[model samples]
Target: MAPKDVMTNCHAKSILNAMNALRKSSTLCDVTLRVEQKDFAAHRIVLAACSDYFCAMFTSELSEKDKPYVDIQGLTASTMEILLDFVYTETVHVTVENVQELLPAACLLQLKGVKQACCEFLESQLDPSNCLGIRDFAETHNCVDLMQAAEVFSQKHFPEVVQHEEFILLNREEVEKLIKCDEIQVDSEEPVFEAVINWVKHSKKEREDSLPELLQYVRMPLLTPRYITDVIDTE
Candidate 1:
């Protein structure tokens, strides 16, 4: 070897350990976070280093910079605890029970890593029964990769997905969007036609206006002549 090289501080574990100890002991903590009736002591430097929201609050000439105790609105105490733990530990347990709530809280705090973890967790949990809901949730939260993944999975499993109770819960526009997808798989057009009819019948007052538009998505030529005649008579 041209020179002897040495590696130190594997994974920065020592630094993280010290920071975690500070977090636990509340030593040198300069700020108090009040979230949904609970308080958490935290260091400004650590929070600023981890979150843009906290960074702006601490670094700016804003009134919050001088405040010893700040109230964080719209997040529950438990969610705040998890957020603080991630800030100190650089890790979090994203579960089905928590991802839905955690994603929004992470987004509010501008914690990109936790938000991304929630999105990844949601992506891994997609299934025929939940893909649509997950897709909607991802879209609502502006998670592009998770939204696309859920949308594609839902489209590919549209036949099976539509049979789920969640399908009937989809509003008129959502139903239209799914029906218009060319990638939706079905052995025959009958299922698609029957799904549309069932959706319309489920809430005629709300869905009747879209019946004519919904019917256009069905492949009439592929349906049996008898069924086609029966549809025409009903129309």
Candidate 2:
């Protein structure tokens, strides 16, 4: 083999050795640290070196079986740089994927910087358009704080978004669908749901009260003789 090929093989072997060392390392907090299969080929070395830090933040194993299948092949250096910066700066844009995983990791290792980043990201992303997905992600990751923030954002923005004719006309089933989609709890005793229900009720009541006034304006006046004579006498 050429010298370049020999060097490449040596580098690959070294990375594999580092990964094995990480896999066999003692659990930091009763959680096994294994390279995610999706991240193994390219990021195994980097991830393995960071295992102890990750273990400190995460209670669950880091094995491939735990997370959804994702393709990280196209991850750019810039992305990694941003992630690292977020970890340090504790500020990040929340629209990035796999944030659920990243946030936990940040919390576990006492990466207050990263945790702050996750919070900021979630705050910015919490809105009527994407609140449901954010709520799901938070619940799945057991992120209570994120969930609460999302609830607040949804409740604040819901009135403006749900006042449309389509939303006003939604049946119970349709409303439930929106609730589920937005990750808003329909059965929970939380104030968020309570506030939403109150808002809807108030809007409906206003519409109902306006109907009588609207009818009075549209109705034709009666042409009774008594009313005509009264009007003539007044004239």
Candidate 3:
């Protein structure tokens, strides 16, 4: 054979490191992505390779295809920098401080790996105080697994969760949905009933009408006979 092909195991990583170096030095970068009035120099090819959002913009007939500078609105500069770090280095730091912002940015960029990382971080950070909020956030972002995890965490700590302001602020529908779930862990039906009353009393003017409807799910049969004769009858 006149020639034989050779492949280097470190070739990919070596190229990435070199590209990162060039990007930091502003060498041979073909595009500038501006976010929140901050400029980030990068190669269109590199960005396209990592994110489908960038790929579509660069390959399509849109006006941005040939534009040397593109402004990405609704994205913070810090979030953009974190995303660029992930694209160039194949790694990212997903922390509580940045995750809320980073996950949305990653979602917009079509970076599934980064989004999954953010979801995992949120899942790990779930607690009685924040589980309800995290559950809503996960649902809003379509992170099904994280949402389920947060839901379970909320129900597992239902007694404590009811003490948080997030629980008190829930609208009628959300309150009803949680109390109806069989998965909620409570010492007894007393806590369940109390949770419902507490949520309603938080905004009585707007929520009092729904109390009668929510009370129907309190599972009267599950309540102790003494509670019915004493607490339930009085309330």
Candidate 4:
């Protein structure tokens, strides 16, 4: 074999295998991660090498450096378990169901790889029914790209999305923001007017006061004289 081809086999594969072996041996682990009431045994060197959060905790003269058990708050035991698995194996399987829960944990841990994976999974699951909610969630988590994608989806499918239960459940501020957007998909403003009417009717007593503000978004001149007279005559 040529010199370059002789060592074509990956050396990193062997290192990963060794790390996996160490991960399985609880007896060799020097540190324990305590999440909620559960504890996970882990090696300090592997964790420090893989995670910047752990690296800083271990390298600095911080309390975590001397402690055998480090208590991790705000993350559930199951989420931490999957994150640690990724740290050891360099692989993660993100699904739509778990992505919502895992993304926040990954963010807190400063695991960029897992966070990005979760964002991509969420982007794949976006649809007319859930786009607005996903946009809000992504913005809250500081996922800029995912938030923008969800917003565009919401704008393009506003007509269909407005009929979903999720749209009815939106808070007053959120509903107002969406109606104010010029990009909302409504043909000739009739659907926009009808959607606002339906929205107010959904919670008549409380939403009645919002009719004037919501109606301003609809182009009154585009509606036929008889259609407007028939709908607004009794109001």
Candidate 5:
């Protein structure tokens, strides 16, 4: 008889589900990941399959490769659990309360998908009051798209944004960066000037010296003659 070839229908989820069950039972687990005083048992192969971090750690001659237990720093135990769930199920849970912490942890694990999802969630939550804070957060985390989106939103809502505490807390360079942008949406130069003054006076002793520098960016030519003589002169 001629050689016969056969194929069987199978789904990938079955394998993951089986692995998840084994993980829960602590069966065939090769390592225990310790985080924040909690120990999580898992299979190195499964972790290697999901995270570049684990893959490199297990494959390289690093001290952790042959260790029976490894300590995971810079992450809370809950975050570690969430990441493990994602590795085993290809799913994750994100919420407003957790995203700020989760995104950094995901980045450390080199889980780009999780980091992107967290960034999108933050972007969706942006508003006039919070856009500045979000932009700063995105910048600190190197989430380029989120930072750009937040910047555009901040400009679109500049009038309302200056009223928030986040704007007042911005350092000199950050304030200069915002006011110097020609794209800042303001009906007149009045608001821009007011924003600069407010930011400077928030810590007058420390920031007062920068007032003249920031004022230079506010276009005086755009102000009306009456207001300039009245409001502008009084300042």
Candidate 6:
């Protein structure tokens, strides 16, 4: 049998034994194992191996009404099966959730095709709304290329998203932390401050007449002492 098949068989046997132990034991254990199985064969292998334990675990402790709580169904089974295959054979078909997990695995396995697929999938799936999560995931995985792509995409398309007063102000608190962090480089441009100033100026220009209060705020002597000094010296 192929190495993947061997691994799958081994994992299935392990799962079965764990289930049998649960069935034979009188006491309920606090442990819960979550599996994502993708293929029917993989599900069958798991079910056949651990049916006794699963049956007991489901039937004894939980009521019929609560069966859904333990019952394996839908995408969960398929995902688990795929994961099993990947763990064993170092290859498996792709899916969205699996793609997220597979990228790191591909990198570990040095599987060029799988790694490229993961990158492509991420690039295609990413949007202004999902960019933050993608950025975080890429960063966590140390996928430098993917992280750069995500950052560039966000900076271009989602600039306004992060430019909100709330985000800018909140993130500013960590400017020092970010600067000190060896991993990330802080830009000297101060995009947040510049964005805010530009927004205020644009709003003022759009108004039928710039609000007197706003004008007064911007024109306040203390607001631009350097500019005021420059003008006075020039005069």
TM-score of 6: 0.36
Clashing pairs in model 2?
A: 56-108, 57-108, 57-109, 90-113, 90-117, 91-117, 132-182
Using TM-score as the measure, what is the rank order of every candidate, best first?
1, 3, 5, 4, 6, 2
lDDT score for candidate 6 against the true structure: 0.47
Q: 1-235, model 3: which lDDT tens digit per residue? A: 5998888899999999999999999999999999988899999999999999999999999889999999998789999999999999989999878999999898899988899999988988998899999999988888999999999999899999999999998888898899999999987887888887777767767876786688888975745546433543343
Q: Residue 207 lDDT in model 5? A: 82
Point out the worst 10-residue segment of candidate 5 by lDDT: 226-235
Q: Scored by CA lDDT, what does every candidate get? A: 0.87, 0.47, 0.88, 0.84, 0.88, 0.47
Q: What is the C-alpha lDDT profile of model 1 across 1-235, one tens digit per residue?
A: 4888779866687787788898789888899999877889999999999999999999999889979999999889999999999998889999888888899999999999999999999888988889988988898889999999998898788788888878999898888989888888788887888788778777777777787788788876755556644654463
State how far residue 170 of model 4 sits from its true place (Å): 1.4
TM-score of each: 0.90, 0.34, 0.89, 0.87, 0.88, 0.36
Please state the error at residue 7 of candidate 6 in Å: 32
| TM-score of predicted structure 2 | 0.34
Candidate 5: residue pairs that collide: none
Best model number under TM-score? 1
Candidate 2's displacement at residue 101, Å, is 6.7
